[model samples]
Target: MASDLSPASRRRMQLALLLTPVSLFFAVFFLGPLAIMIATSFLAPGLYGGVEWVFYPHNYGRILGFADPAFEDFDPVYISIFLRSLKIAAFTVIATLLVCYPAAFCIARLSERSKNFCLFLITLPFFASLIVRLFIWVLILRQTGIVNEMLLATGVIDRPLELIYTDGAIVLGMVYIFIPFMFMPVYASVEKLDWTLVRASLDLGAGPIRTFLRIILPLTSPGIAGGAIIVFIPALGNFVVPAVLGGAKVMMLGNLIEQQFLSARNWPFGSALAMMVMSVMLVMLFVYVIATGRRGADVTN
Candidate 1:
């Protein structure tokens, strides 16, 4: 093919050849696993807790409450768990955005050296294991932890607050872990912001709040949307945070899926639940892309 092509065409062929390995890698590692999971979802669970060769729609039915008559009453439990997961994920996204925006703005306004240093510091935690980071949180938020002792010393409370093993702790853990996702996109946008336009808005007698609302917010919306997507997707499917910090009292979709697979040995039901979570994430990603595309077009216009 290279021998038959012009120089430009040869170069293009070479580039395509180079990308083949990466494409094959993704197909094997990512697409292959997803395909297997989806296929397993459509099959029946065997007596020995594996998938049988038999095909059945029973798993989907179980998830949607079309299974047995007795299972009809349990539909509300699944719905409630899904709704609760959504609420927690939404709260995590909001909290991450709120905290990260100001930090990103400040970093974006800094000198290049300072910006890099700060970014390095913010990402330093990633060098450690995620489980270790979570354990650190447990040490901090536990009833007899340093945080409680510090509060007591400062006379902030008469008793140690129930800081750990609660929904509030789960939210706090999620926000802490996911803040970098929100920060990076917002920082990218803010770093590219035109301060001159802001000055011009001020010179044209627009108030600071109005300038921010009309100019800055609109221009930075794509970044916000990207961050929200990054934060919300993982939070919706989080298991470790809810299990460790929330004391297993608040069961998110991820935990339920784990239970189905591990404890109940119901692989088909777990696959169905996993597919449902994936479906929701795909829908969210689609909406986010459309919104960001429209915002980008508006900015250009």
Candidate 2:
């Protein structure tokens, strides 16, 4: 005996019902996997190579504790690997920012049709397989590769420089792979910006440097944050670049965790290390949000 609802009300109900699928999808795909990973971190390693019900906090402790014959000391080797990963990630972020910022600015300034075309070009590499891209770098940066040959021909170097199988090569490979991530966010932000604000800054007696520092950079800060987080987090966890370009010599936390689980047969320990990385990423993302808020407020003010 209820009265029928209006069309708008029915539409609202339909939309609400539609959102249930999205919510369930997230729960199944994202939250469920994350829960499994956390549960695995607490479980003890099984004899046959799986999770055991024996819960031990020592797995986490052993990661931070000193390496000792008696299992009493912290492992410096793991600490060193973590530090090296941080260093490489930092370098990759810096290099990506330097290369992408100008390119993004240029793309942002282009006409809409041109902008889309340029973006497509940037994304073309993604269509190719990642392994293929890495292999291309191997060919380009090999000892007797085109780069070394060109340098030798130009007399820039007397001998072929060790371009491959080094930390530098790994960083270069990472930067190449990640540059698009850095570019896209910045370009989006830049494209949305009000050009009038920049003109106003210049109209006020602000020089180019002052305008950029005070106006443009602050307005585009969100993009920088997004791009940096995107680049840094993956670079921190990457195993492929170091393995292929670095010849397994420059081991990162990802490499160590991989070795622990696959080669060393220490699932519990690897899970602990992975949990630490995830925890650090969570903390960093929280801090980034706070910093973004402050910067946004400054820009609006």
Candidate 3:
């Protein structure tokens, strides 16, 4: 019904129209903030607050364990913090995989309705705020919490167990928070698994362990990799679980970033910390891609 515009022109125009919103969104929300953060990282710390216009690489040096000129010795605190964050993140990934594999497998084997229900229950926590759910755990783990009261009533212990505000509780909170991320991906892979291979391996006199290690494991490797990456990245940067559960005793990379910005009033240093986190996240994302690509290649071979 329209004008003398050529078909090609109309198609190009339609394509541009479709892409406009997403392109604008990416430019405005993602790239703009990223550019600012990177630029901020290079700026010197302001005399009192924020950042000065002067270029400075010292912020990164500080995080990398170099001492400022005033100090005689190098400070390794930030380096240790980064290492601790990685360790916790790695452990959480392993733990999540261990817990999710069996649970995902069970769900995969269920009747369709039951599988749907189980998956729904697994994801039901999303309906509530994460902080609220974490606080619920706090209630159950505190000295006067449900667990302690139950143990007391049963005469299992005379005193309450120390459950909250510890590394163990922080780990528990992180695991609980991120388990669904691990489970959903693994469940998808398990649901799509070819059980014929498992049966065939068993028939060929390969034991359960051997069959799993050989055939079954390789097939679902992609899902496990995806889940692990998903869990690890967020866990690495997590501040909330450690804050609420571990209290002042625990701090992760996210907390470090938060502290620099909010408490220390060190914008340049905070920006540097943030950019490091973004870089680490990018590396993890690349690893996820490569690992999944190799798994796909192996499957093809």
Error of 2 at 58 (Å): 2.8
| Ranking, TM-score, top scorer first | 3, 1, 2
Which residue pairs clash within candidate 3? none
| Candidate 2, lDDT over the whole model | 0.85
Candidate 1 ranges beyond 4 A from true positions: 1-29, 52-55, 64-66, 70-74, 153-156, 299-301
* Native-to-model Cα distance after best TM-score fit, residue 119 in candidate 2, in Å: 1.2
Quantify all predictions' global Cα lDDT against the true fold. Answer: 0.86, 0.85, 0.87
Judged by lDDT, which candidate is best?
3
**Which candidate gets the maximum TM-score versus the true structure?**
3
TM-score list, all predictions: 0.86, 0.83, 0.92
Model 2 lDDT per residue over 1-301, tens place: 1249888888888898889899999999999988887888888777678878877677776666553235466566677778888899999999999998988888888898998999999988867788888988998999889999999999999999888988889899999899789988988888888889999999998999999999899888889889989899989888889888988578888888899888888787788889878877888799899998887688699
Would you give me the overall lDDT of model 1?
Answer: 0.86
Tens digit of per-residue lDDT, candidate 1, span 139-230: 99999998999999999998999999887889999998887788888888888888899999999999999999998987687789888888
Off by over 4 Å in 3: 69-72
lDDT at residue 266 of model 2 (Cα atoms): 74
